[model samples]
Target: MLFNASQQWEKCVKQIEERDRLIFVSVYVLIFVAGLILNLIALVVFFFHTKTRSHTTVYMTNLAFADLCLVCTLPVRICYHLGVSLHQRLCEAMGMILLINMYGSIFLLSCTSVDRCVAVCFPMSSRVREVRKKAPFICLGVWIMTVGASLPIYFIKPQLPGYQNQSKCFGSFPVYGTRPVAITSSLTVGFGVPLLAMLVSSWGLLRAIKRSQAAQTDLVDSRKIQRMIAMCLVIFLCCFLPYHLSLLLVYLHQRSIPCSLTSSYNYSLMVACLNAMLDPLAYYFTTETFRKKVDLDALRQMWPMQSQSQSADHHSRGPLNT
Candidate 1:
C-alpha cells in the first residue's frame, strides 16, 4: 500500500506501471539530467564563490543542495523501473533521501520567500537586516526541523495483504489507511504551514511591487524580487500543490484508494519532484552574484556582441544598464 492503495491493486498497479513505464522512464531521466546540471552549477556559484552575505544566498544554497540530493534518487528509481537488481537497504535509503530532500526543498523555498517579503516590507528596518545576518543559523534550524519531520519513513510499507516480498523499494504509508486524523494532522503540519507562509509572504511582496509601480518608485531590487516571487509561486502551485492535494484525497477516501487515483497520486509526486530543476531558476532570480559568477552568461556574450556592434553603427552608444 503505497498510500491508501491496498494490496488488491498490486497486480493492477504493476500492470499500470508496465504500461506507462516508457513515459515514467523518460520523465525521470529528463529530470535527472536537467536537475543535476542546474543544481551543480548553482552549488559552484553559491559555495565556490565569495563568502555568503545575503539571506537569499543561504536559503538558495540549501535549496540547491536539497535539489541535488533529490535528483540523485532518480537513478535508483529508474533502475527499479527497469527491473534491475536492487537491495532492500538501498531501496529504504532511497526512500529516506527522497522524503528528506523533498521536504527540505519545500521549507527552504518558503524561507526564501519569507526573507524577501520581510526585506521589501521593512526596507530600512535594521532589525530585519540583523535577522538576515543570522541566515546560516536560521538555515541550520530549518535542516534540523526537516529531518525531524521525515522521521516517519519507518511507517511506510507495502500495503498488499500477505505481501512479504522484498522486491519493492517503497510501499503505502499506513497513516493513509483507517487513520484520516493522522494523515490530516501530519499533512497540515508538514506541508500546510509552509504553504501558508509562502502565500502570505509572496502576497506581501506582490502588493509592495504594485504600490511601488503606482507611485512610480524605482526600487533597485524590484525586478529581482519579481523574478524570485514568480519562480516560487509557480513551483509551489504547479508542482507541490497537486501532490499534497492528491495525498489529502487518498486519505480522505477512508478506504483503499482506487487504481485511478493511485496512478494520479504517483504522477503528482513526479510533478513535485520537478521543483529540483525549477529551484535553480529561483537562484538566478534571488541572487545577484550568482548571475555574475555563473559561466552560462559567457554564452550570452557571444550572441549580444554582434547586436551591440550593429546598434553602435546606427546610434550613439548610451548607458546600456537598465
Candidate 2:
C-alpha cells in the first residue's frame, strides 16, 4: 500500500510538471506574438493619423510605446525558459526594462482615465484643453516616477534558490530583502495610488455624464467615454488585480506553502502574461480614434476599386448624346 501511494505521488508530480511547462511556453508565445502585432498597429495608427493625434491619443501612444518595450523583453524570457544560461547582467537589463514598461504603462493609463474624466465633466472650462497642452510634460513626469520606482530592482541582487550555477537578477522587495521599505513604498505609490486615482476619476466622470443634459451628439460621446472607462476598469481588474493578489499571497504563504506547489507560482505568472493580450483589445474597443482609423483604412482600400467599377460600367454604355 505504501509503494502504491508513492507511485501515485510520483505520477501527480510528473503531470503537474508537464502541464506547467506547456502553459509557460504557450503564454510566452501568445503574449509575444499578439502584443507585438496589436501594439504595432496602435503605434502606427496613432502616429500617422491626424485625427487621432489628440490629447487622448498622446496618452495612448505612450501606452503603446511602453507595451512595445514590454513585448521586446519577451525573447529574453523565452531564452531563459528554454534553459539557456541567463547572465546576471542580462537579467538585470531585462528586469529594468520590464519594470519600466510595466509601471509606465500603468501610470499612463491612469493619467488617460483622468484626462477623459475631466473632459467629460467640464467641457466648457477649457481647463481640460489646457491640461492636454501640457500632456507631454505630464507624461515625462510619469516616466520619471515609474523609472524611479523601479530603481530598487537595479540595486538589489536576487538569487534563484535550489538552482545550481544559476544567474541572479534584480528582485522584487520581499524576494530580495535588500529594500523592503523601498519595495513597499513603490508598490503603494506606483500601483495602489494610481489605481485609486483611476477608479475615482472614472466614477466621477460617469456620475457627471449621467447628470448632464446632453445633446444627441453629447449623449453619444458620453456613452463612448463611459464604455472606455468600463473597459479600462475591466482591464485593471482582470490583468493587474491577479498579479498583485498573487504577490500578497506569496508573501503571506512563503513559510506555510510547500516547495512542491510550484504549479501555483507558474499559474500566477501565466495570469500576468494574459495582460499583454488583453491590453490591445481594450485599446481597440475603447478608443474611438482607433476604431475610426480602422474604418477609414478599410474604406480607403475599397474606394478605388469601387470608383473604377463605376467608371467601367459608364464607359460600357452607348453614348447618351448619340
Candidate 3:
C-alpha cells in the first residue's frame, strides 16, 4: 500500500511539472513576441506619428509606455526559466518592476475609461477643460502610487526553501501565509477596483451612446463609442479575469486544497500579457484622431528629414494640436 501511494504521488508531481513546462514554452513565447512587437509599434506611433495632444492621447500614450515597461521585464523572466544566472537582488528588483507596471497599467486603464465616460455623459460641462488639464497630473499620481505600492518587495526577504539556487523569486511565495495578504491586496487594488470602475464607466458610456443614437448622432462617433466599450470588455474578461481567478486558486491551494490548479497560473499570467498587445487596438478604435491615416513606417524611415519638415509644418500650421 505504501509503495503504491508513493508511486501515485510521484506521478501527480510529474504531471504538474510537465504541464508547467508546456505552458512556459508555448504560451510565454507567444506573449513575449507579440507583446513586445505590438507595444513597440504603439509607442512609436503615439510618440511620433500622432499630431494630436488631446487628453485621450496623453492617457493612451502613458498606458502604452507602461505596457512597454512590463514587456521589457519578460526577457528577464524567460532567462530565469532558461537557467540564466540572476542575482537575488536583481530577481527581487524585476519582481517589483513587474508589479509596478502591472498596477500602473491597471490604473491608467481605469482612468481612460473614466475619461471616456465623462466625455460622453457630460460633454458640455463647464469643467471639461479643467478635467482635461488634470490628465498629466493624474498620470503622475498613478506612477507614484504604483511605485510606492511595489516598495514592500525591498523589505520582504524571499524565502525559497530547498531551492535556494533557483530563480523563483516571486514564484516561491507561501500561499497561506504573508504572501496571501500581498497577493490579495494586489488583486483588490490592481484588478478588482479597476474592473468595477471599467464596468460602471462602460455602462454609463453605453447609455450615453444610446441616447445620442436616439437623437441622431453622427455615425462615426457612435461607432467609436461602441468600439471603446467592446475593447474595455475584452480587456477585463480576456486579460484580467483569468489571472485573478488563478490567484484565487492559489489562495485555496494555500488552505490545503488538494487541487492541481497551481500549474495553470503561469498560463493565465501569459494571457494577462495579451492585454499589452491588445491595448493598441483599443486606441485605434476609441479615438478619432488616433485612427487618422498616417504612414508610420515612412515617418520612421525619414525621421531626420521629417523632423525638420514637421517642425516647419508645425510653425506654418500655427501651434501643435492640443
lDDT top scorer = 1
Per-model TM values vs. the true structure: 0.79, 0.74, 0.76
Q: Which candidate is the best by TM-score?
A: 1
For every candidate structure, what is the RMSD over all alpha carbons to the true structure, in angstroms? 9.6, 12.7, 10.0
Which residue pairs in candidate 1 have backbone atoms (N, alpha carbon, C) closer than 3 angstroms, thus clashing? 1-158, 1-159, 1-172, 2-171, 2-172, 3-172, 7-160
Across 224-293, the per-residue lDDT of candidate 1 in tens digits comes to 5566677668778898888888777866763555677767777888888898898887554446522332
Best-to-worst TM-score order: 1, 3, 2
Which stretches in model 1 have alpha-carbon errors above 4 Å? Answer: 1-5, 155-161, 171-182, 213-228, 289-322
Candidate 2, residue 300: the lDDT equals 23
Question: Per-residue lDDT of 1-322 in model 2, one digit per residue for the tens?
Answer: 2223223333444455455655666688889999999998888877775443567777878888888888888788777655566776787788788768877878888887787666555543456568777888899998888787677657754443433243433212235222356546545876698899999998986775565443123223556656767887887767666666555554555444333433454465556556666776876446653233222222222245543545534334221000
Q: Give the poorly placed runs of model 2, Cα more than 4 Å off.
A: 1-19, 158-165, 168-174, 177-179, 215-225, 254-257, 260-265, 289-322
* Candidate 3: Cα lDDT at 280: 71
Pairs in clash, predicted candidate 3? none
Task: Estimate the TM-score for candidate 2.
Answer: 0.74
